[model samples]
Target: MDPDDGEGLFSDAFPTRELPPASAFPGQDPHALGGARDNILEVAIGREVRSFRNKLGITVADLAAATGLSLGMLSKIENGVTSPSLTTLQTLSRALGVPVTAFFRRFEERREAVFVKAGEGLLIERRGTRAGHQYRLLGHNAGNTGRVVVEPYVITLTEESDVFPLFQHSGLEFIYMLEGEVIYRHADKLYHLTPGDSLFFDADAPHGPDEMRQLPIRFLSIISYAKDEV
Candidate 1:
């Protein structure tokens, strides 16, 4: 084996094929999305993929063969040159013998109990550039075969106006006000909630904070979704 022939090693070990351009994927335009070109999520996914492959002593060629993806496409994905779609991610996860969520964050083995200390949760931005909203993922059900999908988060709202668009998802949501006050809007109705107040509603119905009073307000939000839905 020639030490200088990196691509040749893979070609000799497995069959090679040409991959379509990034734009070929549905709704993906490599030249159009500037911010997504090197976004944090893409970078994180690439890093994890590369790390996992290396840990398994598998070369890029091996991964390409296992995933039925072109070597060039795999290279681009591992290098964060492009973001993989959900289908592509699922393929990779299957090839790697891990769940799709593994690309997002590390997964721990199932434990009978878990603990999260105050101010120690992982902050996540699920809503994209939404301002005045801080979300800290308190915890998630771990293990690959965990049936229930429960995600508890600490949400802080500082926006005084209700200009933000309502958001909805498929699941049940419960919110318990912890500090300050806010007008919570669900569907077409609004309810004022203060400390010790709680609201349970269908997450499918559009809901958001109608108003944030007493400056910054903190609350606990627990969302439950079917395991398959996750």
Candidate 2:
């Protein structure tokens, strides 16, 4: 199927929202949210890249040559010290002989529904404990049907950094701020969200949260992706 065809699928599956202008967050630079430091998503990508490279008996230099990236840059990416851009991830995907989706966690089985009482969901440590980002998986598909899968999670953020690593995938993402405030960055724009405010957009766009305020800002994130894409 043509790659562009998926855009229609996304539109049909999820309702679109008009995004506010980047100036919505006046005087805020989206680039200021991230730097040489790593976030959970970057760490996960780094680990996956290293694992795939090692499994193929490939060296950093070899990967650098294949991906046309500098050895130093690749090293920083692999060490979770820096995050790669969409173009960089695509290049690495080609070099590793895998789809870009391979960098994300995989969920196989499908389930009709799942329930998690307050404070009872599985606590995931993707960003590491020191990062002060808490992610709890609420539910996901557990069946074998190769249809679109929906996974929901509750995220608690305590990081005070102005910048953060961004991530993208082949899917749609919906975020609803539950408590406190946060600056949600999508591509080149930033949206300030408060309790009850929600944002929905294409997941393939590089996006993340920055400038989290209030000791612990909590939100609900729902990720929808085609099962076959995994």
Candidate 3:
């Protein structure tokens, strides 16, 4: 029971109960991706194997024959139903003409990031939309070959900005008001958003700004959509 241990339940510097878990989030995030960590490595390996096999124009049967593994075993491995041993992975690597490490490439891939300086974001033109709105592309993953694509933008509306209602698109959208008050429409619903306010909605239905309650409005818009099928 040393007070200097800093392991006490109510320690000033390292209180155990006060620290949040690694996966704990600040608040309810509308557009936040779920935190599911189960079988991620297996899934990544399976996808990589399948992708390589397909790229080589080889079927599962062909892969099995090349690796001297059974059809059922290869099927299980490719579907990520079971984890393969190092020997099995080596066999797959040889048969697929890839390195054994390639199977885990996706699972061990480095996390990517993009940083934009203040007032350095790229300006974007909104097609098929009225004028007076300024769209700045804050950040986006460059040439990401992943399953999901995310685009973040900062939208500013001035007195001359046209209120374009009903914008239809695919995927999900999130908005956080930064500078002004506005009424936003999503499908049949309307939300009055002020500074620090937020909204999340499905983009498949029509949605857009309904009214500008305050001038020089600015907001962050984050959109998430699935990548096109290869």
Candidate 4:
């Protein structure tokens, strides 16, 4: 898939509203879709990023310097103007002392039940080459509870993509290989994953796809965290 090409594999967009609380979903796990299960993960990246920044009282300039990114770029990312690359995200994680997963948190519990169906996943296609490809919402409006988000996705390497940009966010990520194979790049390390194989990693580590992509890879990913804790 061409990064510049806007045509997505799943053409239809998913329907979404605010999610219910973590308790409503049970297990404090975001990966568990209670009703009408589908192949996607729920992510509130925007809310998470803002929460972390606000909590730390970090300015865009401060974050840019710490992440080795330009102030303008960092501002764009925070303001929803641009999507930071995996590498850019890693830089921020290192500077923040929080796991890369910290970039994906929500401070409030969800109130409504939200569902993302196949062929209609909601996405945060912010300005930038790298988009926050959120497959589903873990839970929402639940008062300070925890939940997990499980999603299925395919990583298609572009001819221009020499490496998967390093990224970190605000939770734990469990990746289960489904189809194809690719090198999974974690901070200063690389791991090859195949079908049925899985890996658990800290969200704050700089991670992304390895450059040696011989095929389009598919995987099931679960992200989990407690909203109240943050």
**Best-matching candidate per TM-score:** 3
Error of 3 at 21 (Å): 16
8 Cα displacement, candidate 1 (Å): 72
lDDT of 4 by residue, 35-144 (tens): 33211122344445556777899876777777677877665666554556677667777787778766654323343555656545443332213543333333334443
Q: Return the number of clashes found in candidate 1.
A: 0
RMSD of each: 23.1, 20.7, 14.5, 21.8
Task: Tell me how candidate 3 scores on lDDT.
Answer: 0.79
Q: Encode model 3's per-residue lDDT on 171-229: one tens digit a residue.
A: 89999999988887666556678999888777887888887888889999998888772
What TM-score would you give candidate 1 relative to the actual structure?
Answer: 0.49
Where is model 3 more than 4 Å wrong at Cα? 1-99, 107-110
lDDT per model vs. reference: 0.76, 0.74, 0.79, 0.56
| Backbone Cα, N, C clashes tallied per candidate | 0, 11, 0, 41
lDDT of 4: 0.56
Better of 1 and 2 by lDDT: 1
Extract clashing residue pairs from model 1. none
Q: Which candidate achieves the best lDDT against the true structure?
A: 3
Candidate 4 stretches with Cα past 4 Å from truth are 1-116, 126-162, 228-230
| Per-residue lDDT of model 2, residues 1-230, tens digit only | 22223243345444345767887868746578443233367777887899999999989999989988999999998877787999999999999998998875421212245778888888876532345567799876746465888879898876443345376777998999899887776765567788999988888978887566554788899989888777
Sorting all predicted structures by lDDT, with the top scorer first, yields 3, 1, 2, 4
